[model samples]
Target: MGLSNWPDICLGSLTPLLPEDFPIDEDHEFKPDNFYFLKGCVHFKNTAQILDMTNKVKKSRWRDFSQSFLRDVDNAAKKADEEQEKPKYEIKSCGEMMRTIKTMVDGQKGEKICELSMTFVSFDSSMVRFPDKEHSRHPLEICPVEAGSENKHECFVRHSIPYFWDMSSQFGTLYKCLNQKRVKIASICAFGFGKDAVLAIEGDQLDDVCALSTCIILLNGRDAMDH
Candidate 1:
C-alpha cells in the first residue's frame, strides 16, 4: 500500500505519532524517537530492554566447554541457574496451529499474556487475555482490506470497540482504535527479511505488552511463511 492510496482517516490517525514530513512507504523506514530494535533486543528509552530470542549457539558452546572440564553434577546445577537467569518473556509453540506468549515469575511460567492461532484459508487469530477480576479476553481478527491481494503485509485487525483494533498497511504502520477512532501505535519496516528489519513503537495509548507481543507474532508468522 502506498501513501497516496491510504485513506484520509488513516493518515489523520498517524499525524500525532509520526512526523508530518516523514515518508510512509515500504522503502522508507519508520523511526520512532523512543523505541529501537537491536539484534533481536527491544530497547525502550529509560525502560527495561527485552531479549526477543535466546542464543542457541552460545548455549551449545557453553555445554561443550563445560563437559570438557566441569563434572556432570556441577554442570547440571550451573545450567539450572542459567535458565532461571534468562529473560521472563517466552514464545512457545503449543502445536502446529497455536502458540502462546508466557511471562515467567519466580522461575515459573506466570501468565499466558497472548495466544496466536493459524488458519489454512483465512487470516490468523490472536487472543489477548487480561489478568484481572473479569479475566477479559479480547480477540483480534486479522482481515485483508483488499481481497485476493498477494501483498501478505497489509491487513486489518478488528477487535471489540473502545478497546483494541488495528489496521496494518504494507508500509509497516499499525494503527490502533481508540473509542472507535484510529491512531498509529507501531510500525515494522523490512518485516520478516534481513537484519535491517526494524520495529518502532510510539506513544502510550496502548498497552506496551500487547503491542510488542502482537508485533512479534505478526513478524514470526511472516518469517515462517518465507521459510
Candidate 2:
C-alpha cells in the first residue's frame, strides 16, 4: 500500500502488548507513546583496539618520555576498549539456509537472541526461534500478506494461527501467540525498496528483540526476491 495509508492501518490495528497491571500515568494526556523507526539497512562497527608491545617498546625510545605523552596514549587506548566492550546486536549467516541474530551479553560474550531459517518446502515461508525461551525448539512461522494489487509496500508480522488463516477477512486485526495466549504485540510497516527503505513500529510493543527480528525478516525477504 502507499506509505501514507500505513499509519492509519498501524494505529487502527494497534493493541496494547503490556499487561493490565503495568503502571500508567493518568494525568499525562498529551504525552506521546515512544516508538522506533528502523532503516532497511543497518550498519554496526566495533572499535576495539589491539595493543602491540613491540610497537610500544620501539616508539618509547624515539617518542616523548614525558608523563603527558604516556597519559595521552593510555586514554586513547582506554576509550577504544570501552567502545568495543559495549553490548550491541549482530547478525551472522549460518550456511545458506539459516541466519542467526545475537547480542553481546558481557564483554566479548555472545548470546543468541533468535534465528531465522528458510523453509525447504516453501521458499516464501520462514521460521523464527528464540533460543533462550523454554520452548526454544518450536519455531514460529512468518509470511508476507498481500496488500492490494497496486500497493508495492509489503507488510509481514507474526500472527496467531486463527489470524493467519482468516487474514483475508480480518486483515484489520493482528494478534501474536505468546506462551499459549494470543496477544497483540507490534505492527511493522516497511516503506520503499531495498536499502533505502524504512520501517515504522508501533510504540507500545516495541522492544529490542521485536525491532531486530522484524528488521532482519523484512531485509532478508527483500534480498531473497532480488535473487
Candidate 3:
C-alpha cells in the first residue's frame, strides 16, 4: 500500500511455522494460500494484536481494508514457499524444474524411467508483487480435496503434487485496488508452463512411459472477477 504505516506484505517471504496444509498436486507444488492454509500454519507471531486490530476496523475502513489485504499477502507468500518445495521429473519450465527434468530426460545420462504416480495434494495462488513496493510475500495454501488439484495422478487422491502461482503475474494489472500493471502475457505464460507437467521421454519411448499433463487454460482473475 502507498500508506507507510500499514504492514508490508510479500508473496514469498514467510518462514513457515508448521508443515504446509496442502500436499502436492498433479504437477507437485506446495499450494499454501488455500483456505486450509491458516488451518495448517501457525498463526502470525502477533496473533492477538492482529486480531484486535481487525476487530477495531470496519469494511469501509482503509486501514482495515489494507490490513486485510496485507494479511492475504502474508498468507500468499507463505503458500508460495510451500509450493516451491516439490518438483515432478515429468514437469518442465524455466530454470529449476526445467533443469531438473533436463537431467532426467537427456538420455545421454541414461536415467531410469520409473513409473511415477502423483496424487492431487494442493494448489493455490500467491498475491501480486509490485515492483514499486518492497512488500513482504506470503502464499495461500489450497488443498486439492477442496477444489481442482491441477494434477493427473492425485487430482482427487490425497497424495497428489502441489502447485503455486503468483497472482500478480496472472492478474497484477487488473486488480485495481492493488494498482498494478495490466495482464502481463509473458508472466502469465511463464506461470502457465510453470504449473504444467511436461513428460519428456527419449525418442520412441512415449509408449514406454504412460504419463499425462493437465492444466486448465482458464482466463486470469479478471475472468473470475467478471463473474
Candidate 4:
C-alpha cells in the first residue's frame, strides 16, 4: 500500500502459484482471518544508509534519521522514473506445511535481516499468536527479529481490543505493539473502511513497524474482500 508521505509498502506474491479458479474457503465454519499461510514477499523502497543503521545507534539519532528521510520524501517531488528506480527490499517466507518458517529482508547490497519467523513450537494453534491480539487465543506465534539480526527474537508486540460498549464504531481497533519492556514501537488506527488505515511508527522502530504493518495490511485486505 502507498502512503502519501512515505515510500509505498506493498505486499503480494511475486507470482501466483495457485490456479486462477482456486477455491476460496469463505464458507468455512471458523471463518478466515487475514493472516496468510502461503509464500510471498513484502516490498518497500529503502536506502542503504537507513538499512545500515546499527542497533547501538542512540534512539534520538535513529528518530532524527527517520524523520529526516520522511521530510526529504515530503519535500522533494520524485519523478516517476526516479521513484521507480529506488532500491527495493524484499522479505520472502514459506508458510505452514514446513515445520520451519524463516523470512528475511534484503537490499541491493545483499545484506539480510529476518523480518519474522515461526517455528514448530507445538501442534496446538493457541501456542502461536500475533503480538497485537495477545489477549485472544490465537494459533500462530509471530516473533519479531531484532534490528540487523536474522532469526533473533528480541520482543513481541501485544494487541488489545476495544471494550464491548465501544465495539460498534470502534470495532477492530488496534493499539500499537509494545516490546517486552512495555515500549511502544508503533501505533495503528484502522477505521471501518478496512484498507483505509493510518500507521504511526517511531524512527527507531522502522524495521519492526514494517514487518508488523505487513500483517496488518493483509488482515485489512481480507476484511475488505469479504465485505
Best by lDDT: 1
Error of 3 at 147 (Å): 2.3
The C-alpha stretches of model 3 lying farther than 4 A from their native spots are: 1-106, 118-145, 148-227
- How do the residues 1-227 of candidate 3 rate in per-residue lDDT, one tens digit apiece? 21234233322224321112432222322111111111111111111000111222232422212446445534543454576522122221122221111111212233333211222212332122112212112221221222332321111110121223223232211000111211111111221123221111122211111211111112211122222
Task: Name the candidate that leads on TM-score.
Answer: 1
Q: Taking the tens digit of each residue's C-alpha lDDT, what string does model 2 give over 37-100? A: 2322332111111122222222332221234434433454455456653324445444343332
- Model 4 residue runs over 4 Å out of place are 1-82, 98-102, 118-183, 189-199, 205-227
Compare candidates 2 and 4 on TM-score and give the better one: 2
Please give the ranking of all candidate structures by TM-score, highest first, separated by commas.
1, 2, 4, 3
Candidate 4: tens digits of C-alpha lDDT, residues 106-199:
4455445433433333211111223443223232233222223322222222222110000113222222222211223333334222322323
**Ten consecutive residues with minimal summed lDDT in candidate 3?**
43-52
Q: Write the per-residue lDDT of candidate 1 for residues 1-227, one digit (tens) a residue.
A: 12333332211122222222232234333233333232232211111223322222222222212333123323433454477644344444433433333331211354555554433333334333444422223444333333244444333332232222222444355655443334555655442234323344554544545555555545444334433
Which consecutive 10 residues in model 1 have the weakest lDDT in total?
A: 41-50
By the lDDT metric, which is better: model 1 or model 3?
1
Q: If the candidates were sorted by their lDDT against the true structure, best first, what order would they fall in? A: 1, 2, 4, 3
lDDT of each: 0.38, 0.34, 0.21, 0.27
